[model samples]
Target: MKPFDFVQPTTTDAALAALAEHSPNVRILCGGTDYVVELKHGEQSPGVVVDISRLEDLKSIELTDAGLRIGAGVTHTEIMAHPLIAEHAPAMIEAAHTVGAVQTRNLGTLGGNLVTCVPSMDSGPVLLALDAQVTILGPKGSRQMDLSEFFVGVRKTALEPDELLLDVIIPTENLGKPAGFIKFGLRKGQALALVNAASAFRVEDGKFKDVRIALGAVAPVVMRASKAEAVLEGQAVSQDLIDEAAKIAVGEAKPIDDFRASKEYRNSLIEVGTRRTLQAALEAANG
Candidate 1:
């Protein structure tokens, strides 16, 4: 690892100040699961490392007027255990569980995972499915944006060098929205996703409404299957519809040929994963 000064800030303001003072030359560290590895591999050589892991404000999970605010510093283990999250967005728990094995989950922050902007990141699909909003704090106060807008590309985000992700909010309208998450991997234990999917919607008058399907590991950013979602919205749920939509979803993704899996295999997984997750979501809605 490269020699770097470390500053552990107790408050969000202090953290922002640290970022403002040293950013571009500095890197923020939360769980260190990803950043630490980047540091050790000499992938990132920040002059200063701002550790916000202990910033209490960024670690709370609670309801607010805006919606359910999940602080960025919250850990995967915390997400799995939180009663509100369990009750309102259970699919998120399933997603968090697939992030890594127990040890890494214990140390990984939700913000870190999303901020890393990896296409295969497990935390992304569920949040995107829920229409989650992200809060970013910078030198000029804070701003909120759609979670989709937060991601730019592989290892890239809309966040500025001096801005820090504060929290993510699942909108009030989507609270307890029926959703399902699925991840396909080679061995499942600490494996990067071959293809992962999430489906969410409202069941109204025996028809699907506000249907949303999101996919990861098959695009530059975790992306929504708008074509598939369009097929389901305002339509009656059925096996045929799900199958057709899943096929449409395959067309939405541009999966890459890689060492872990082939593009063709990923496309197939996308179809199956999309169908299954959509079915699971429909079941969740029915019950």
Candidate 2:
């Protein structure tokens, strides 16, 4: 790791001031899961490293009038073990389990993962399917946007150099919304997802309602497969309808031929993933 000045700010205002002072030379340190690896690889060497990991206000998981407020500094381990999350949105816990091994999960933050904006991030698909929003803090105060808009591209985000991700919020209406997340990696642990997908919907009068299908790794960003969602919306539940919807999902992703998997293989996985998540979510809703 390159030598750098370190600052541990106790308040958001202090962190903002430090960021403004350092401006482009500052890197906000959250969980150090991705950043530490980057530091060792010489990917970044900021002049000032602002450690926001100690910010108590940013390390929480609770319910608010708005919905579930998951602080940016909350670790994956916390998410996995939170009883409120298990009762209200277990799909999040399911996704968190696929993030990494026990060690990484202990140190990684959900906001940090989303802020990194990697295409294959395990935390994204389920959140996207659930219509999650992200809040960013900077010198100007706070700005909130859809998680999709927050992602710019590979390893890039809409955040400016002086900005910090605050948290991810799943709207109250979506609480207990039947959602499912699926990830296909080379191995069970410490493997990057070849193709990951999530689905959420309601079964109203035995028909699908407000269906959402999100996919990752196969696209530049975690993307909603609207075409597939359209196929299921208002449609009666059936294996045939789900199979058809899954087939449409394959057309929405832009998978590439790489060493991890071929384009054809990814397409097959996308179909299977879409179907399985939808079925799982439907079961959750029924229960």
Candidate 3:
């Protein structure tokens, strides 16, 4: 790993200041699950590394007026254990459990997963399905954007070089929303997803409401299967409709041919994953 100046900041303000001082040369470190590997591999060579692990403000999981607010530094293990997350967004717990292993879960932050912006990240699908938003802190102060807008491309995000992601919020309306997540990988554990999917909706008068279906690993970024969702939205719930929507979802994605799986195989996974997740969400809505 290349040598770099390290600054451990105890407060969010201090961390932002450090980032501002170092500007484009600075890199923020939270859980270090992803960035550390990059550093060791010589993919990143920042002049300064600001460690925000000690920043208390970025380690909370609370029910704010806006929604369920999860600090950027909260680890995957924390998400798996937190009562608020379990109550408001149980599907997130399942998603968190699929991340790496026990040690990686203990050290991997949700923010880190999102910030890395990998297409197959376990956290992306559910967050997108739940309509989560991200808060960012920078020299000009704070700004917020939809989680969908936060991701730019492969290994890239909208976060400015001198900005730090603060927290992610699942809107109050989405809290307790019925949702389901699925990750199809080469192995049962510690495997990258070939296709991961999440689906969320509410059943009202036997019709689907606010339908959302998100898919990862089949595109440049995790993306909502809007056309598939449109197929189910306001429609009477039926197994046939779900199967059709799942097929529509496959058409919406642009999966590439890769070593882990072929494009055709991923397309099959996308269809099955979408169907299963949607079925799971339907079951949740029913209960």
Candidate 4:
């Protein structure tokens, strides 16, 4: 790696200023789990590295009128340990636990995971299923957008180089909503997800309501299975309906043949994963 300048701004304003000053030439480093590896391997070579790892402004998990506000700098381990998250968003805990491993989770920030924008990122599906929104800080000020819109494509996001993600909010209406996340990998530890899926909904009067399904790794970006969601939503839950929805989800994905797994294998995983996550969410709702 080439020699570069390193700055660790102390305040949110300072961070924003640093970004505005050297965005295209600078790289933000919080939990270096991803960026550090890139720097070492020459995948990224920024002229300036802005370290925000210790910035206290971006580390909190609290409730708000809007919903739960999860600071971008909040680590995966913090998510897994936070009592509020455990009570209201348990599926998020399950997802966070699946990230890299104990050490990586200890060091990785939720913002870093999302900013990395890898399709198979473990933190994404559960949040997407919960209809989360992201707040971003830029030179012009702050802006909010649905987490769905935050993602652009593989290793990309809607975040401009001059902007820094501030926090993630799970909308109040979806608080404590029954949701489940599942990731399929070749082995139990540190394996990239072959296909990951999440589902959420309410069981009202014995019928599905507001069903949501999000999938990852099968496409360029993490995506929702709206077609599959349409199949069982507002309908009475049944094995037949679940099976059909799973099949629809399979059709919705565009997995590609790769060394880790074949497109055919991923397609099968999508069906099974979507079905199981939906079933798990339904069971949670019922209980």
Predictions in order: lDDT: 0.95, 0.92, 0.96, 0.93
Provide the lDDT at 39 for model 1: 92
- What tens digits encode model 4's per-residue C-alpha lDDT throughout 122-202? 989999999999999999999999999999999999999888999999999999999999999999999899999999999
lDDT of 2 by residue, 140-202 (tens): 999999998998899889999999998889999999999999999899888899999999999
Error of 2 at 2 (Å): 2.2
lDDT digits (tens) for residues 88-206 of candidate 3:
99999999999999999999999999999999999999999999999998989899999999999999999999899999999999999999999999999999999999999999999
Q: Least accurate stretch of 10 residues (summed lDDT) in model 1?
A: 36-45
Residue 221 of model 1 has an lDDT of 99
Which ranking of candidates, highest lDDT first?
3, 1, 4, 2
Question: Distance (Å) between predicted and true CA of 62, model 3?
Answer: 0.3
lDDT of 4 at 118: 92
lDDT of 2 at 61: 90
Error (Å) of candidate 4 at residue 195 is 0.4
Ten-residue segment with the worst summed lDDT in candidate 4?
36-45
- Give the Cα error of residue 256 in candidate 3, in Å: 1.3
TM-score of each predicted structure versus truth: 0.99, 0.98, 0.99, 0.98
